[model samples]
Structure formats: C-alpha cells, structure tokens
Target: MIQLLFILLMIQIAFILILSFANPLRKLVVKGLDLLKQGRGPLVTKTVAATMCVVLSSTVYTITKIQKRSKDAGIVNPTDEVLMARRLLEAAFLGFSLFLGLVIDRQHYYIREINLLRKNMETAKKTKSQRLLKEMSGN
Candidate 1:
C-alpha cells in the first residue's frame, strides 16, 4: 500500500510539472476538455465533484469501521494502512478534478482571446481598406 501511494504521488507530481509548462500535450488536453465542456461544463464538473465526495465518504467510513473492528479483536489494522490508502486515493481524485477545472477555465480564456484578436484584425483590415480607397479616389 505504501509503495502504491509513493508511485501515485510520483506520477501526480510529474503530471503537475508537465501541466505547468507550455507544451503541445497541455494544449491538446485543454482543447479536448474544452470541446467536451462546450455548453454543459459546470454541470459536468459539479456532478463529478459530488460523485467523488460520495465515494470518498463511503470508502472512508467503511475503512474506519473495519479498522475499529480489527482493533477490538486485539489486532492493529496494519498501522491504519487502509485508512491512509483511502485518503490518498481521495486526494488524488480531488487533485485531478481541480486540474480539470483549471484547464477548462484556461481553455475558455484562450478561446475568448482568440476571438477578440480575430475581431480586432478584421476591424483593422476594414479600416485600412477604406483608407486606401479614399486615397485612390482623392488622387
């Protein structure tokens, strides 16, 4: 269990590092989530969060009861290993959900920025063309 937790933590750290950088993989991930989020992003996020909460609480409760029973039977629950495992798993899921939310928000911001840039470019082009036409007619 400890080994599994260590491996999971390592993977999570690596993932966060990768996300911190500006890379094609990050862009792809953000773009994919953005596509999925189109109109129902909030609903999806909320649903996932609620589900995680339910699962985490239930798992914790079960582990705690098992540990208590084992202690009553004059045995240690392996240093609370099961509880630790459950909490670690819950943390991982929460972290992933948070990362997903942040990515979706960033993608939305990028999309808005792109649209704004396009509009500005089009306006500039139109004005330049109008100015050129006026100059030609003036001549």
Candidate 2:
C-alpha cells in the first residue's frame, strides 16, 4: 500500500509537471532529442550543456543534503542507500527544471526564427512581383 501510494504521488507529480510545462518545454524535449540524434546545431549544444549542469548541480545539492542528514542523524556518516535516494530525488528535480527552461527558451528561439523567415519570404515575393511588373511595362 505504501509503494502504491508512492507511485500515485509520483504520477501526480509528473502530471503537474507536464501540465506546467506543456508549451515550449514539451516541444523542446522532442526537438532537442531529435537534434541530438542528428548530432548538430546550437539547439542540441545548449540542451546538452543544460543537461550536464543539471546533473552536476543536483549531485552537489544531494551531497549537501546527505551531509546535513548525517549531522542530524548523528551517525558520523550516512549509509549509501540514504545518500543515493537523496541524490536521486535532487537530480530528478534539477533535471526537470533544466528541461523546462530549455524548452521555453527553445520555443522562443523558434518563434523568432519563424517570424524572421516569414518576413524575409514576404519581402522576396514583393520584390519579385515588382520586378515582374517592371518587365511587363518594358514590353
């Protein structure tokens, strides 16, 4: 029953996370993973950097937690199990935060790029039409 409760809690947490990050974050994850497989570009590079930072920061935070726990428990040192669980939870949250940030940032970049592309395309079409009109008048 306890295990089931934990699972339900985790599911609820995950749902909230997904809901909170439903916009660009979700899109960023899919795009970043795809970019990773393709193995190129600034998007993938940023994602990889963000991911590494998340992992390292989470490790540091978890170690600090373990240190605090050991001091509180007065056990001189904590067991591997306790420390590992603490670290895992810290890492999970950090990773999620990083992922969410990346997604939002990536989404913004995508929107900007799209806007620029559209503007360029519109300008090109207008110029081409003008050129055609000039040629028609000449004839």
Candidate 3:
C-alpha cells in the first residue's frame, strides 16, 4: 500500500511538472474540463477547493495527533503507513486544485477570445453593409 501511494505521489508530481510548462497539455485539460463549467463552474470549483483545504488541514492535524500518541505508547512505525497514505491523499488533492485553477484560467481565456471575435465580426459586417447601402443610394 505504501509503495502504491508512493507511485501515485510520483505520478501526481510528474503531472504537475508537465502542466507547468506544457501549454498544449494545459489547453487540452481545459477543453476537457470545459463541459464541467457550463454552469456555475467557478463557483463549484472554488467550493470544492475550499472544502478540500478544510479536510486536508483537519486530516493532517488528526494524523499528527495519532502519530504523537503512538510514539508516547512506545509503538514503532505504526503511523508510518498512515503517514504515507496521508501524503498520497494530500498530493492528490493538491494536484486536483492545480487542475481546477488551470481550468478556470483556460475558460476565461476562451471566453475572452470568443467575445473579441464576435465583436470584430459584427463590426466588419456592419461596415460592409453600410458601404453597400451608401453605394446604392449614390447610384
């Protein structure tokens, strides 16, 4: 179980590192998560992140207390496995938070791009129509 947790932690770290410098991957991740944001995306993502933060802090505190109690009782390595598991859980949550942030950033980028395009298209069409009307009236 510890080995499995270690492997997962490593994978999460690798993913985060890749996401940091990989623009294409970031776009893909954002597009993939776009469906999730069709409604209340930011709100839901923020809520989840806040909830995870609370859970993570509480879990860490509980784990530390357990470890301390075990140490006082002269237990050896009893908390070692639990600690590894906790670390894995923490890493997973952190990775998720990072992904959510990226998703929000990408969503905003796309929204802005789309709005700019629409504005430009409307301007172009309106100008072309006005020019055509002016030419017809002058003739």
Best by TM-score: 1
The number of the candidate with the highest lDDT is 1
Q: Taking the tens digit of each residue's C-alpha lDDT, what string does model 3 give over 1-139? A: 3355456456656545544564667656545556666788768977967866776677677667766767787865745767756665765665565565565566556655875899999999999999999999999
Cα error of candidate 2 at position 33, Å: 22
Q: What is the lDDT of residue 76 in candidate 2?
A: 61
Error of 2 at 108 (Å): 1.3
Instruction: Name the better of 2 and 3 by TM-score.
Output: 3
Decoy 3 TM-score against native: 0.45
Model 2 Cα lDDT, one tens digit per residue, 2-120: 35434644654553454345565655555554464464666666776676686668698777777777778876653756666766765565555555556545555665577689999
Error of 2 at 88 (Å): 1.5
User: C-alpha displacement of 71 in model 3, angstroms?
Assistant: 20
Question: Candidate 3 at residue 135, lDDT?
Answer: 100
How do all models score by TM-score?
A: 0.49, 0.43, 0.45
Tens digit of per-residue lDDT, candidate 1, span 16-94: 5555667777666556656766789768877966876676567667667766777788866665676666666765565
Winner of 1 and 2 under lDDT: 1
Candidate 3: worst-modelled 10 consecutive residues by lDDT = 1-10
Reference-based lDDT, residue 6, model 2: 48
